[model samples]
Target: MTTLPTRTDKKLGLVIDLDICVGCHACVTSCKEWNTGGYSAPLTDYDPYGADPDGAWLNRVHTYEIANDHFTGTVHFPRSCLHCEDAACVTVCPTGASYKRAEDGIVLVNPDTCIGCKLCSWACPYGAREYDHDQGVMKKCTLCVDRIYNETLPEEDRTPACVRACPTGARAFGDLGDPDSTVSQSVNDRGGFDLMAEMGYKPVNKYLPPRKGTDRAPVTNVAPAPEQTGSPIEKLFAWADRALSR
Candidate 1:
């Protein structure tokens, strides 16, 4: 069994806004492109073009439709490793290949030491872990550990690839340990919440809930004109002429 650090000086994580995510999958594609040749190289795809294709991905987007008498809309959820403060995935690893960093609290798997055990994936509640059949090892999102602190990259480009790629500005990354950080302030203002808090993983990543649509004025319903104005055939032809002129 592995042990986690009692405390860390910094807790670097993501803050995702559910209201802004458009389900574009840009973050997903960019993450795959950067990480395939990055820290966890070659996020292998088995028969990607075939009828049944699967691959290891660090980030994924899920869309769900919500409907009721009063409200109906789509929710785009982007999920990845939360880098929990009390990570069960690390504790359950028998090979000690999975560990959380004491410096920044980023959970990582040492592929060289991993023995292709699936325990880490089972232990993770978020289903963030992915097993690479070719490498015979479990892999997951490392918060782009290789990019964040690299001096070679420009200062503006030091954040995670997903954060950089999100066009709607739905994703944000920063040190959660600092109360004064912009990400923390956004979480505070928006009442950002963790997923499955009941499981007690204490995930560092926060999600800003979708804003209520009630504040916006309701759409006015326009009724069609009565057939008494003209015969049905004549009305149809008139509508077509008006549409073409417009």
Candidate 2:
């Protein structure tokens, strides 16, 4: 089994805001696009155009209809590797293929050393691991390690592809170990929480809970436009006028 680092200086991870994710799937698509050609290349799609299609993806978004006595709404959850402090995936690897970086706390699989055992995938609690059928190896989100630390890219564009592609700015990446970091402070102020904390994996990534109704005005509260009051030809002219104003 692989041994994990006793400590990591930087807990680099994501802060996902469930409140405004919008289920756009932008992050998922961008992640697949970037990684499929980068560090974890050739993310194969089996029978892509056939009846029974399957593929490997690093990130995925799920939509859930959350309901209870006090709250009711749809939640868009974007899930990927949480980069846990006590990563079961890393510890379970018979080869040293699975390992966590001591410098950044980012868990990764070395494809060259991996033997496609799938033990790491089975050990992960969050279901973040992906099995590359073509390569016969376990694959997962590297937090765009190739991009994040690449000095070639502009400083502002050095975040994970998912974070960069989020249309609503729902995903964030930073050093969670530093209390003063923007990501850490956002988590602290917004009551961010870990997924399945009882599992004891101690995930580095945090999720900001969906805000309650009282916290903001409900979408249903917005009044619809009043019915247009005018003759048929006048209404046509009015509609054209409105369209032209833009």
Candidate 3:
């Protein structure tokens, strides 16, 4: 069994804003492309191009038509590995394959050491692991560790592929350990929250709740337009004008 580090030098993670995400799935595609050849082995597909297509994907966006007092609209929730501080996935691995980096607190599985056991998958509350049927191993999001630390690329391009490809800039990456970091500040200002704080996993990734848009209804307690007393011909013209204005 593996034990988590007492502490990490840096808590690097992603902050996702629920308000701005547009459900484009660009992050999902980019993650698949980069990790397939960069850090992990080629992602496998089963019966793809057939009636029953199935494949492994590290990232996915779920669309929800949520309704509440504040807002009611389509919300796109992008989910992946949260890389928790008290990662049950790591501790549950019997082969010592699952580990968390002490330098950055990034949880990862050693493909060589893994025994194709589903303990890590069962332990993860977020359902972030994917089983590669062809390779007989489990796969998951690595936070693009290879790209983040790559010195060959431009400094600005060192972020994860998901962060780079996000069209709406809903995803952000930074050292969440630092109180002064932009991610931390955004979390503070926007009321960012963990996916399941009650579980006590202490997930590093934070999600910003959707904010009420200004363009929505009830623009400062606006009253309905008053009905005007007029001739039948005048009233019809006024109604037409009001409809056109709307």
Minimum summed lDDT over a 10-residue window in model 3 is located at: 213-222
Q: Residue 129 in candidate 2 has what lDDT?
A: 96
Off by over 4 Å in 2: 218-246
Ranking of models by lDDT? 2, 1, 3
Q: lDDT for model 1, on a 0 to 1 scale?
A: 0.93
lDDT of 2 at 205: 99
Collision pairs in model 3? none
Ranking of candidates on TM-score, top first: 3, 1, 2
Candidate 1 regions with alpha-carbon error over 4 angstroms: 67-71, 216-246
lDDT winner between 2 and 3, please give it: 2
Model 1, residue 3: distance off in Å is: 0.3
RMSD of every candidate to native, in Å, equals 3.9, 6.9, 4.0
Alpha-carbon error at 105 in model 3, in Å? 0.3
Each model's lDDT comes to 0.93, 0.93, 0.91
